[model samples]
Target: MRTLTSSTTRRRLAPLLVTFSACAVLSGAMTPAAFADDARSHEWYLDAMQADSMWKVSSGQGVTVAVVDSGVDPSAPELQGQLVPGEDLNDGKAGETEDRTGHGTEMAALIAGTGAGGGIQGLAPRAKILPLRYNVKAPSMDTAPRGIRYAVDHGARIINMSFGIELPGEIPGLREAIDYADRKGVLMFASSGNAGDKDNVITAPASMAGVVAVGAVDKSLTVTKWSNHGSELALAAPGDDIPMRCANGEGYCSSGGTSQATALASASAALVWSAHPGWTGNQVLRALIETAGRPTEGKVPSEYVGYGFVRPRMVLLEHQGDPGAANVYPLPNGPASASSSPAPSKAGQAVSSAPQHGEAEAAAGSGNTTLWVLLGLGAAVVVGGVAAFVVRRRSA
Candidate 1:
């Protein structure tokens, strides 16, 4: 279970503000303090999503997400004891948890931070992180797709890829890894790109079919001017003015990008999955698309904010949030129900672990179609070895 948060772009970096007791202060609702100390403050979106309220029901306790990025610092206060053993794919280092540039550490905290010593709070505080490092920085010509495949083979239920590369064309190996993950029931989320206001191009992994492509938005809920817009987009989240552990790992500051949004979205999915133990990846994703927020004109799921903002509460609150046809896989090229008969069960009922909500529920788009999918959801009927390729070009 993992999901993305959205953010907007600003000329200057915003100061990190402590969002203690924000749910109570903003919504007049009682919620616990994810981080009660003074030194570490997470991005405001955590409180905005009522994370504490959601945590009481399910803190993503049963989910494991593989973070494929520069590297994850396993010693961060918030990440102490959360990182599982992983291998380095760079071929330059054996430890995937050793973060050289600290970007991965920030992403890790945003996904599953424990909020130890006021550290940056995670959207899914109970979820476990499996650090898988790759070269996403300067002077790098490493094939990160190898790392992605390895993570999938491992026990990671979800893959979090925050870095985006605009390769001239899709690499066969990378596509295989992605397709493999999809077949394995592993949900993959990636950043669209940071150069949104300019090229706004669809980056690798994020643009691929069967992948959940995320974009950034601001506190005002408007899509960031820098966020890429077009098909291949699935959902949006809080990406701007996000507070994260600094590069030095000593303090915190506000950062903005589709990267942070991707992490948060992964965490959100984790929460939903942890709550609904019996649901499949399609059901979890369907709930996300079904419950997202939208505007007055009956929710415009634009290329900019695909399916609107990600809101898991709507799914968690419902007893039956569109599990859809269980036997039929959700992806387009994936497997179809071999037998159409209703899934034989003890009772003619569908069970979900999502939390129970009071009369009030989060805003779900008005559209009749509660799911988002331009790609197939069924299990991959075809799996083949992809030819290896030399790293022709690389960037930081």
Candidate 2:
């Protein structure tokens, strides 16, 4: 059993220093008083992704996403009525709402926060959260796998795993749990990892088959330097300088990581799933991949950005993308293809054995430049109600 740890990296903001009342912190009661007045202003991706327009179509009303992390603070203002009954895989003593590291609560808020009392506004504001707590430091590997099974057996349709382990091979129990979830029509998303500039090793369960491995990109749509990359990387999302509720129950903090990217990807799926309530997990994932922003110059499934940045607006607002066959899983190593090829079970094996497309980093840079130009053109069209073309002339 591999020990799981949070994939998020938080940076305290000196300028945004509003703390909850001492009494509230001591009494273990989360209050709205800790939220900063200008917190929402920093949620740049909401506007960039045109969440308001998407919200008009679906707020993920009926979907329940299981957040398997440290824990969740159900009392948080944004999560007041959003959580369902949850379990603590660590020990039955502290329930799922006791958020030890604050990471779980942050992830939950990102997926379904209602923005009450100036709190974070979730992408899928109406969705419900089922918090499943796993002890990060516990030596037992059973916690994560048990949590995954618990979510699948419960009413969860999507599971957001914002934590990861950089292991050389797959843990049988963990892999089996993920496979089980897939069989039950549950879509799983995990942070690829945050060691892009460092070790850059693939992490599990992200590299595992049947899971959507998410990487991070900035407001410019450029893949962040710290987001892990590999053949298993399935998608990218805005993850840089993201704002979230602080763990200390103080004001919000600005942070960035693949963890945030994974949450957004899961939330994006919820939005699509809620709109098309009858769609299977395969169909929903198909829609997401088919509509994702792709590179102009390189073959898709790029190691850096995968199918490209996740743009649910294309599915929700524009009515784009084909939700292909319900029974057929979309990506590699899907259930549809599981029996044919050996499962890419080991992180090291998955990373080393997969065929390398061109230089991933180089491809990503060129593709992002094209994507930015396209986004700029799209913005111009929205403003002017006419198609705009930008031709970049090369110097002779």
Candidate 3:
């Protein structure tokens, strides 16, 4: 469970606002020399996250995560040795590791970067990074569903989508791809979006079922006012005043959003999963939701932070966590059913019995996180097995 920051009351913004102002957030600007600064020395969240204490337990080794964003610059000094070969959902090529906006690289650094070149260090430095480049919000008019479908078709274990849109009515191809990924045994995470200060609406993919919605939080451990609030939110993480290497491949800079928080949440999941290989995704998620940080009282979740701010160290260091059912998803979907309760998992139990080729091939085609492609469709069901309701619809 990952969470970010937010305000309890809404602030009225001037009409025709160019860019929504955030409370206590860093602007998205990167300076050239800031990249050469000591990356690890600038990671202030580690101290609050107790990362040093958690690292002694698990470094997220043996875990492969798929980053679905603009693109990742493989040549980044700190990320040089950590990135694995991945696909570009945009043009169906293999050379999409080039970071166009630097946001993806920042996310990659947050997840698995080694901090070798004075770049920001990652929470799980030992974990492998699989970059799946896509353009969900591209300036171009062309649209293709194959990017996400292709990633799901590959071998990604965990899919982290840090981009989003607000299109109404579920698009057939996109929904199908999401369903396909779910059946394949993947654990997908997405940003809750940066729209709280405007329409106050949550974005799709984040609003979709089976995707863990992450929000942003600040050093004070309070939710940021700019983060979107809604029933779609699952957890929150540190997103405000966080430092990252410049977006231009330059030096270090600071910025905040559920985007960065989503990466941190994914890193948190990697830590828990790497330590417990046999545990199903449901078990892993159950531990996170159960151990999340509570900023306000009452069992009922807030529209802003959901269950609470995510505290991965609690799950990694504490030995007490019930994985519940192996097949069942603890979180419920649909607008009427927003909250999730602990349930048993049925995810990997039938892997030996299910048809292993077409679905498996689609899963293998997804990307580096084998689990993402392998089990996403299956995990979308009630208990992590193939859903009776899931339909196989192909994309053009």
- Residues 1-396 of candidate 2: C-alpha lDDT, one tens digit per residue: 344557777756544654322122111233323435356776767876778888999999999999999899988889999999999897689999998788888889889999888888889999999999888877366777898899999999999999888677978898889889988989999999877766777688898988899988654445666678878988888776678766565666666788988999999999999999999998898888776655544445667777767878878877877886677777866643332222122211111121111111112124233322122112412323322112121111
Better of 1 and 2 by TM-score: 2
Best by TM-score: 2
lDDT of 3 at 382: 31
Worst 10 residues of 2 by lDDT: 350-359
- Model 2 regions more than 4 Å off: 1-3, 15-37, 336-396
Q: Considering only N, C-alpha and C atoms within 3 Å, which residue pairs clash in candidate 2? A: none
lDDT value for candidate 1? 0.62
Cα error, candidate 3, residue 321 (Å): 2.5
Candidate 3: 10-residue stretch with minimal lDDT: 387-396
Ranking by lDDT: 2, 1, 3
Q: Write down the lDDT of every candidate, Cα atoms only.
A: 0.62, 0.74, 0.61
* Candidate 2 accuracy as lDDT: 0.74
- Which ten contiguous residues of candidate 1 have the minimum total lDDT? 385-394
TM-score of each candidate structure, all chains considered together: 0.74, 0.82, 0.74
